[model samples]
Target: MRARVHVLVKRALSVVLSLTLLATINFSAHITSAEAKTRKPTIAEINEAKKKEAEKKAAADKAKAQLNAASNQLKVLTAKAVAARNRYLQELKKLEIATKKAEIARKKEEAANKKSNAAQVAVVSSKNHIGKVAANAYIMGSGFTDFDSILHADGPQDLMDRLSTLDAVGENNSSILLRLKVAEESARLAKIEAEEARVEAVAARKEQADATARVAAAKKEADQARAAQEVEVKKLQQMQDKLIAELLSARKKRVTLEQQRQLAILEEALAARAEQTDVKAKVWPVNGIGFSKGRTTIRSTESIRTNAVAFAKKQVIARKPYVWGNEGPNSFDCSGLVYAAYRSAGLGYPEWDRVNSRIYYSWTKRIPLNELQPGDLLYYSYKADISTIHHITIYAGNGMMWEAHNTRKGLLYSSIYSIPGLIPFGGRV
Candidate 1:
């Protein structure tokens, strides 16, 4: 009875399994029928898509170029502002010197004024002294001479002594007048010096005013220059920020379009294969898990350490400018980009050159054509020899590769094996 029950359970499980298989088959058929009903895109449709994509790329490139121009302009404006500020400082220094000279002149004028007042006082005192001497002589000399005639002297000797004393008094009066004249001359000289000092003080005050005006003008110019520079810098910054965002958006769109293109290519290839072989269309895995090429089912792991790291680095640097020999950050050359990509994965592949390109091949394992994986380097050359390889790129699978292509194209993605060169094989590091 136990055996019979076990048999019944086994039959029930088999029936359930059969039903699940039927459902899966029905689902597959439905998908195939849906696909069959749809037609491939026409040439016109493809051309229109290409045109739209081209327009977007052109706009993005134009924006990038404008941003570079704005950056250069900002540098120039900054220099001009600095020069203006320097000139302003120099003007300010000149004004300071002028002001100091004016102050010195004013002090000199004040001293001259004091000297002039003293000179005026001396002239007045000298004139009054002359007048007093003259008055005394007139009164005494006239009255005493008249008395000489009215009152007779006791003897000739007394009369002679009186005339002689009168003559001595007249001589003293003449000496007083001479001293007064000298005082008047000194006072006049002092007055002349005082006038000159007053004129000098006026000139100095005017100079100070001019210096102050110059300082104001220089400060105004410097402020204007700084304001202009700030305005332009802010404008350029905003424009550059906008352009950079557009650039990134363009790159993201390109990535999406590239994905769609890869899918379309795969579908076309699979459809053609189905028509020729008369078999169910299968979705073949390129970089994802569970890739079965034939009898061998290759179950790729969910993640590859080197591949993840290297591809992540490439994505970070995508759409950068292609400089002649630059290696990273903002620009790169062809081989330089490849070296960077692997280095980002912690592989540290050296830069590839005509001589070192061959050396690179030696460092990596030669992968089979069917076993090509992401992070593998695809080498192209003029000849089959590795030494002749002129270009290298990082493989991203699904017929895509990342590279710094040319000066015009910059760092971008491309379809694998589509490039026209002697591609001998792929290498894995």
Candidate 2:
């Protein structure tokens, strides 16, 4: 019995040893896997990373190219829209002038017809009077020829009176004939005048109709062009948004790889550029009219100008929305914002209130680009002419500008030099 128990105990110990060896083997395998995961990547893996980076860069380049193409397309469309709108306005003016001419022609036609009718009536009346005179003369022809007045006379005075009446009737009949002749000529001339007036009225009406049609067609074209431009603008905005997202992603990755000190300097520069402060009584870095020693020489206009700039900057900081033709506390267009800012600053353009960018262009005095000062009105034209000026913004100091840029950008501060279609001159209100 003792020998059997010893063999069984040895078998149990062998089983326990087998279990311990298996646990050691599993722990060693886990350690090997952990070390493999923590090890640096191989050259092949580094090459794969580089390939991915190159692919991302290629995608970025392609997107940038697409953005540029879309921006150019937008410029073309904007020009088309502006031209269509101008054509429509011109047609409206022509329509107004034609309508006035038609009205005048209509009045002239009425007056001419009335005069012609009166002259014709006179001609008929004169003919009837002549007929009555001829009938009386025929009825009394034999009696009058046989010395009837002398035969019917009672005394010398009576005979003389009868003879005078006879002579007066003869003269009266002759005068009626002459008047009738004159009336006939007058009626004929009046008829010609009436016909000429009728022709003029008809022509004026035709011109008015043609003008109306042109105005309608012009308005339709303008609407279509505006709609197309709006659609392109939306598409351009989407592309820009996507590009910004991709840029942000790439920037985040770069920031992760860049040194901490370098990142700090970059952030600092960005922050400094974005900083806004009051300019009241401060030395502005400007040289031009009303400026002396980097300070405003004219205090009378200085306060007003600075106030306008302040008002515009406040809206920009508030991120006001851009709305076409809007002048408000909520939203504004480029010219609307400028008008409102100046109006709020007590430098109101009463005569030119709510006018377009072109009108604003005329209201300002030209200053060279190098002499730009804060609160100066900046103008831009696609055709580089005053008549085609389409955009206006207030100049903020340090080469920056405040503008209600567009639907996609809203009210924002931007580098004046970087924008497209910049005129080399600015305006001082």
Q: Provide C-alpha RMSD values for all models, in order.
A: 13.7, 29.8
Q: Could you give candidate 2's per-residue lDDT for residues 1-429 as a string of tens digits?
A: 234323533555665546534443343233222211112334555455555556666766776777677668667766766776676677667667766766766676566667657766776787788677667768976456328889888988989988997888778777876776766676667667666766766776677677667766766776676677667667766766776676666665543343233333433343344333221111111221122111222222778889999899888767799999999789999999998898889964447488898777666776655577889977766543456567899987655678999999899776553344455557888
Identify the candidate with maximal TM-score. Answer: 1
Off by over 4 Å in 1: 1-168, 181-185, 192-196, 214-222, 225-229, 259-340, 348-429
Q: Give the runs in model 2 whose Cα sits over 4 Å from its true position.
A: 1-54, 141-167, 215-219, 222-226, 250-429
Query: Which candidate leads the pack in lDDT?
Result: 2
Candidate 1 per-residue lDDT over residues 6-31, each given as its tens digit: 35335556765465345434533432
User: Against the hidden reference, what TM-scores do the models get?
Assistant: 0.43, 0.41
Model 2's number of clashes is 0
Clashing residue pairs for model 2:
none
